[model samples]
Target: MQIQDLPYPDPGVPDARSGPRFLWWLFRNQLGGQVRSLAWGLVHFLSVSALPFCVGYAVQAVVDRSGTRLALAGGLLALACAGNAIGDTFLHRAAITNWITAAARVQQLLARKAATLGSALTRRVAAGEVVAVSTGDVEKIGWFVEAVSRFTAAALTILFVCVGLVVYQPSLGVVVAVGLPVLALAVLPLLPRATRRADFQREKAGRATELASDTVAGLRVLRGIGGEELFLDRYRSASQEVRHAAVRSARMWSLISAIQVLLPGLLLIAVVWHGVGLAREGRISVGELVTVYSSVMVMTYPLRHFEEIAMAYSFSRPSARRAARVLSLRRATSEDGSQAGTAPKGDLYDPATGLLAPTGRFTAVVCGDPDAAGRLAERLGGHPSSTEEEPSVLLGGVPLDELPLSAARTAVLVQDKDPVLLSGTLRELLDVPASGDVDAREALTAAQCEDVLAALVQGSLGAEDPLDARITERGRSLSGGQRQRLALARSLFTDPEVLVLDEPTSAVDSHTEARVAEGVRELRAGRTTVVFTSSPLLLDRADRVVLVHEGEVVAVGVHRDLVHKEPRYRAVVTRETEPEPEEPHDLQELEELEEIEETA
Candidate 1:
């Protein structure tokens, strides 16, 4: 593939049976690039291999005192030099091109797999493993892919040289042929031990990486609990383990490298000694002796590629396996085993909890345990739990697992409590696959996030519009309230048929939360909306409130009636405070407060 065509439009479904199989699949896909690289490598290796012959010819021509033949040798030597330069240049060009394109392809596949798995990716694999596979593993895989063609060329070039030597003088040729194999095979016994050590090092490194990732992700929480020092100690221990393993791995590789150096030198010595014996016997000319020695020296260059290929495969094998494991994860499938149809529409029901939200109504779910609330919210989005055999949420009598991923996602949009905001401009952040019914302004206003837009405008460094203001990664630059509200706005803008929001207003102040609740109730009218919260303002605005204690529904009614009757529901929402006799604030009153806040 061309560099410009990189990031393939379709990275095609991968074969994930095993790491070696996956590597084979990647090789098959890039056969054209592999061919191009191989062809260039042949040109390069062949040209360099011809140099020893040129040198020998020149020596013999001078030894015979033939002026014409010496002149011809000079011309051939110059051509060989030019060929070497041209071939080496193009070979590198093709190898690097293959490397970049292969890396890009793997990256795209990982991205696609992550998107398909959604939040469950972290559940199945450690966050650090995913990070490592996407970053370091990609390059290793590309290294193996790029090395394949060059390795083949090197082997073929070695074979050509060995044959030429055997034909030039049978005695010297046999000695060189036998010696070259010994030199090449000498490191084989050491490879397995080196590879084992390397694997151990990689495992330790991965564990350290995982610990570091977990520490960073929860750094804020760790500091709050005064446990950063404890985590630091743990990470230091992990780092030390990694260091020891790495040292062991390096020692093995160093031994192998030493063997490689020593073997080549020994082979060169043998060739020189044998060539001199042949010259003394008058079985080979002085010129032939020079050619055989130069040829043996030249052989070292191609032999290096054998070690390179081994190293490349060693590093890439595990990386490819890790990537394959991730790609093999499949979402819960339907009972019928198909996912190519239209999205269903109806009451949102969770059979596992026996909780139901009627069609086109705003429903509030109050879970005493926050973790339970988050899990239920994820379930509403068709995410399968490790404990559950399949996703039990259904829409219009059809299980969500039965629907295509695109259809299910379009039908039910879930905004978790800790929603992430990728770095981008305001426009890009809000640019989701949204319904045309809700525009950016309407959604922003409904989410009570006008202040968020105002802050972005005030923070702009240039004459950029509010929509053009750039957001930092994960919205780190914004306050907790602003990030929450901005995410809420994006959800509202999506305008899905069914929306599940978990603690969407937890970060905002009571005043802002009250207005946001009213805005949500009004804008989501006649659409299925389920909010997992204990906030009184939001609960009161809901058309129906369900108290989910433990896992099952314990009580269900309007918020006003439920507060007076269901003590569990009242205690959860009101935090054990005596329920006020008065109903919630009216919509017009909240709107007036919104106007006053804007004026201030």
Candidate 2:
């Protein structure tokens, strides 16, 4: 395939069981491209090999003093030169196409795998290792794939030349044939040592990269606590380790390179020495002697490809292994089987927690244990903990865990308690895979971010539009409340069939939280939403409230009724120290409610 047609429609599922299998899978999928490259490589190798024979023919013709022979040799030389040029051009073109397409395919697969794994990817795979695999290892893998075809052609050309030489002149031919194979195989003994050193270098580099990443990510915190120098010193030590390992690996590879040159030089000397002896005994002509000498030189060129392919394989094998490990990670509660495309249309229920959020209602959940709250919220969205054997969250009549990942995601979206905001423009941050029904401004308004856009614009780097303003990494430039609201806005933009939010407004002030609660109630009208919070502002807005204690649902009722009638629910929400609050305290609490403002 051409480079322009690349990044294939889908990178197809990878055979990620092992490194060798994954590498084989990549190469096999690109068989058509590889075959074409192999053909061009063959042309290049054969044409290059033909040049030596053509020169020898011309030499013999000149000695014979025959004009016709001289003219014929000249014509053949021109043809061989033309063939050589054409073959080299196409060989390089095809090889490059193979390399880029293979890498692009791998990139797509890794991206798909990452999307499937979500936040869990970093948990299972080191962040630095993932970065390293994506950035550097991908190219090395593609290089090996591209090298395989050329190496085959080189080996074939070597065999073909050896046979031709033997038929032309036996005594000299034997030496050339034996010496060429020796030159190719001589570096094999050193490869394992070189590869071990290379692997050590890669490991050191991955650790150093992880250290640097962690240092950068926590730089602000480190500076706050005055621990900057400590981290810097640690990273410095890691960088030194990486440098040392790289030097050791380079030393081993350098030895291999020296052997590549030394062996070929020795082979050339042996061929020439034998050819001269044969010529003296009248067993070979001057032209024949010249042919054997030149043939050895030609044969030595393709031998370099052998060493290159070996190095490529050594580098790429480990790369493929790492990529495979990442790709093989499966979500603990997700299924990859057939599923309906449409979202389930009914109540959301978590069987283990016995929490029921009825259809088309605003439900607020109060969990006495914060840990329990987090777990329930994630479980509601089908992201159950791997160690727990909880029953699947159900929707309509279907278990979400049994549904396809995309279908399950479409049915419900759970905004984590601590939502992360990646660095990007405000517009890009909100540019998520969504139902596309809710407008960004509408979601922003619903999340009570009416002032956030203005703030972004004021702090923007010359950008007049708030949506176009750049957000620093982790939204560090924005306040905690602003970040939380923006995250809530992003979730609202998706407009899913059911939305579960965990401590979504914990960072906002009481007044703003009240407005946000009302806004959410209005915006999510006629849709199901489960909000996990003990804040009366949000709970009072709920059409129904659920009280869970120690992971089990203990009570369910209207917020005001539950506060007055249910002691356990009241204690959890009010943080009660007495049997009940005083009359004035009750009055204050009632007035603060303002009763959720009837959804705007």
Candidate 3:
């Protein structure tokens, strides 16, 4: 596959059984490109290696004083140089194509997995690890894949040169043939130590990356709590640890490099020493001695491939393992068993906790535990839970998990307590796949997002429309309340058959919360809306209020009725006791005051 043909029509499922297996799968998928690279690489290396032979022949021709022989050698030298140039150019092109395509394939696989797993992905894997894998790890994997063809060509070149030498001169050829293998294998013992140190470095680096990610994500919270310095110190320590590990790994690899150079240098000396003795004994010509020396020198270039391939494998192994682990993750809902192109319409029901949200009504869920409330919200939307045996929520008496993911998502939408706004223009943020009569303007009005619009205008070009104003990543530039309102506006704009909101107004004031509650009730009048909240302003607007205590429905009624009768509900919502009424004034004191006024 070429770079222009990128973003493959079908990236195909990866073989994530094991790290090595995954690497093998990638190589197999790109076999055509790899072969092309190998072929060109072979041409290049062979032409370069043949140059020494051409020079030796030219020397011999000069010694013989034959004009025709000298012309032949010159022609052959020019041909070899031309071949080398063409091979080198094509080899580079093929290698780059192989690298980019391989990386793109892996990246596509990762993106597919991430889309399937959704929010649960971060829970299973660290955010920083995911970042590292998708970025640095992907490059490492591509490096290894691209190295394979070159390494193969180098090995073949070494073999061809050795055979040619043996045919031309046995005494020097034997020395070279024996020494080349020793040079390649001599560094094998040091590899284990090098690999161990590399693994250590990678581990420490992952931790450091994770620490930095966490610190950056929570920088605002840390500043609020006066703990920024503490986190900075922690990150500093992690970075130091990573640096130390990297230095140690570099030391080991440096030793391996030294060995690579030293062994080849020793072999070169031996080949030259042996060839000189053969020349002195009149066993071979001076041209043969020069050829042998040049051949040994050329062998050094190919021998280095062994070390390079080793380093590439050592680094890429762990990267591939991480990528495999991510790809191996399976969603709670089985994709194979999902019923395709089906969208169920009716009341949302979670069998796990017996929480039922009836059709065409605003139902409020009051759960004492916020985590439980969040889980219930996710369940209500047919989002896959972490459990295995627990059945998914149902829509219109059909298990939502059985429906295809796209259909399920279209039918029901869930907005979490902390929803994110992707970096883009305001219009782009609201550009979701939505149906029904709702639009951006109406949803914004219902969400009481006038302040958000004004903030956007003030933050950007004053003449620009609010919809055209840009929003920073995660809506970081906006205040918490503004961000929450914007998220609510986005969800409302979608206007799904069923909407599950988890504390949609938790950040807003009571007055704005009341307006938002009323607006939602009016806008979603004939749709199924489930709001998970404990605020009285929001609860008062619900057609039916259900209290979830200890993972089950404990009470169901209007918010006012529940507060009056259920002390637990009252405690959870208001978090205080009700005050008693005072007694009336005495009647005798009123009568005495009336008689005194009559006497006067």
Per-model C-alpha RMSD:
10.5, 9.2, 8.3
Please give, for residues 475-553, the per-residue lDDT of candidate 1 as tens digits. 8778889999999999999999999999999989999999999999999999999999999889889999999998899
TM-score of each: 0.92, 0.87, 0.93
**How accurate locally is residue 520 in candidate 2, as Cα lDDT from 0 to 100?**
96
Candidate maximizing lDDT: 3
Q: Following a full C-alpha superposition, what root-mean-square deviation does model 3 have from the true structure?
A: 8.3
Over 4-114, each residue of candidate 2 has an lDDT whose tens digit, in order, gives 887687678899999889999999999998999899999999999998888999999999998899899999999989988999999999999989998998899888888
Q: After superposition, how far is residue 542 of candidate 1 from its true place, in Å?
A: 1.0
Off by over 4 Å in 1: 333-340, 574-600
C-alpha lDDT (0 to 100) for residue 396 of candidate 3: 93
